[model samples]
Target: MARKVTNTRKWIFTCLAWGVALLIFFPILWTILTSFKTEGDAVATPPKFLFFDWTLANYREVQARSDYFSHFMNSVIIALGSTALGLLVAIPAAWAMAFQPGKQTKNVLMWMLSTKMMPAVGVLIPIYILFQRMGLLDSRTGVLIVLMLMNLPIIIWMLYTYFREIPGEILEASRMDGASLWNEIRYVLTPMAVPGIASTMLLNIILAWNEAFWTLNLTTSRAAPLTTFIASYSSPEGLFYAKLSAASTMAIAPILIMGWFSQKQLVRGLTFGAVK
Candidate 1:
């Protein structure tokens, strides 16, 4: 009787979980399905869940209307560039804060996080003017720099937490063995913290890839990415549902694929320091 009750409860929880997953995924699934429909079918009064006249017309039209490859390349470059730059700055900063002592370290970290809480639009004017003056507008380098800066604090904080879990004695042992500072970090600290670093980098890449507002405003044609490509479908006239769905599918496909493949490593790394 108890076993039967437990099984029933387990089944109920599983059903609830699937229900929520389907509810959240319905939009994306709908978009993909809509991409295979004609514009007329896409926005039908009784929205077609399935059994619509399927066609590749929307995808073909999306390709004809935009340079899909260019936008994809831009997104790849910006996302990878920003992640690399953030890691470069964040690793050393996290190392120092994690291993070294300072009374103001916690305060400084809190202050850095506070920046993320403030609205991005609040500083838009200043950043925009700065970019204009510096000739960074519509440039890949400019967007890369901005994305790196935006994600830096979070990257540093996550790394700091991971690094803190490592015993200081290992570093001390390295120093006693005549390991130089560079050698200590390169050989000692980094290898053990690989999982945390990997997870942080993956998460940052995803964040940079999906960032729309900053990319939309700071870029036009030259440095425009997939986000910009999707935005281009919108106009004052009205939404092009089928074409928009196609564009969105194309834009999200790469990252979704990447996340699917890397989920194991990401999960392992995220949980690296949690256990003894």
Candidate 2:
């Protein structure tokens, strides 16, 4: 009877979980469906769900209207570049904070995190001017740097959290064995922290890929990413519902596929130290 009761509760929770997942995914699903519809059908009063006539016109038109490939490449470059640069800077910072003793380490960590809470708009003007003066505006290098800096705090914090879970004695043992600082981190600490680092890289890539505000404000055409590609569908005249949906679907498809394939790794990394 106890087993039966537990099974019944388990099934109930499972169904509820599925329901919530579907609810969350419905918007993306709807956008994909709408991408295949005509402009009239996309904004139909009754709102077509699955029973509408499908077409690829929107996708074709989106392609012909703009250089989709260029924006896509821009997104790839900025996302990967920022993540790589962030890891380079963050790994050492996290290692220091994790293994080295400091009077104000915790305070420093908190201060880094507090930067994320401040609104981006608060300092946008200064950053914009700086970028302009430095000739970084609308350049891939500029966007990459901005994204790297923006996500650096999170990367450092995550790496610090994961590093804290590692046994400090192992690092001590390496040092006692005459391993240089570079070799100690490169050979020992990094190998053990692969899962944490992998997850951080994936998360930061997604964040940079989806960043719209800075990208939109800073870029025109030369360095515009997929986010800009999607935004182009909007005009003062009105929204091109079908074309916009098509653009959005194309923009998000790559990331969604990546997340799907890497879900296990992401989950494992997130729960890396939770159990022990």
Candidate 3:
């Protein structure tokens, strides 16, 4: 009787989980479906779900109206570049904080996290002025720097957590074996913390890729990413529903595919220190 109760509860929970997942995914599904519909069908009063006439006209129009490939490459560069830069700085910082105790380490960590809570708009004017003076506006390098700084705190915190789970004795033993500091981190610490680092990188990449506010405000042509590509479909006249849907679908497809394939690694990294 107890076994039967447990099984019944398990099945109920599983069904609920799937229901929630589908609910969350419905928007994306709608976008994809709308991408294949005509403008009339996309915004019909009754709203056509699947009975609409399917066509690739919107996709073709989106492609012809904007430089999709250029936007795509910009997104790829900014996302990967920012993640790589963040990791470089974060790994060392996390290593030090994890292994070396300082009087104000916890306070400092809290300060860093607090910065994320402040609204981006609060600092926008100052940053914009600085960017204009430095001529970093609408440049890939500029965007990369902003993204790297924006995500740096999270990356460091995550790495610090993962590093804490590692045994200090192992690092001490490496030092005793005459391994240099660089060699110790590169050869010992990094390999052991691969799962954690991988997850951090993936998360940061997604954040950077989806960032719209700064990208939209700062970029006009040169550094415009897929977010910009999607925004182009909106005119002062009105929103082109079918074209906008097509643009959104194209912009998000790559990241969705990447997330799907790397879900296992992401889960493993997130759970790295949970058990032990």
Cα RMSD, each candidate: 3.4, 3.5, 3.6
lDDT, model 3, position 65: 76
lDDT score for residue 97 of model 2: 91
TM-score of 3: 0.83
For candidate 3, lDDT tens digit of each residue in 1-276?
999999999999999999999999999999999999998888898989999889999888877877677888999999999999999999988888889969989888889878877889999999999999999999999989998998888888878887788999999999999999999988998899998888788877887999988899888788998887667655634557888888889889988987886675555444433433
lDDT of 2 at 53: 89
Predicted candidate 1 versus true structure: per-residue lDDT over 70-105, tens digit per residue: 888999999999999999998988889899959989
- Candidate 1 residue spans exceeding 4 A from truth: 44-46, 236-239, 258-276
Query: What pairs collide in candidate 1?
Result: none
lDDT of 3: 0.85
lDDT against true structure, model 1:
0.85
Alpha-carbon local distance difference test for all models: 0.85, 0.86, 0.85
Model 2 spans with C-alpha error above 4 angstroms: 1-16, 44-47, 236-239, 260-276
The true-versus-predicted C-alpha distance at residue 123 of model 1, in Å, is 1.5
TM of each candidate vs. truth: 0.86, 0.83, 0.83
Cα deviation of 226, candidate 3, in Å: 2.2
Model 2 vs truth, CA RMSD: 3.5
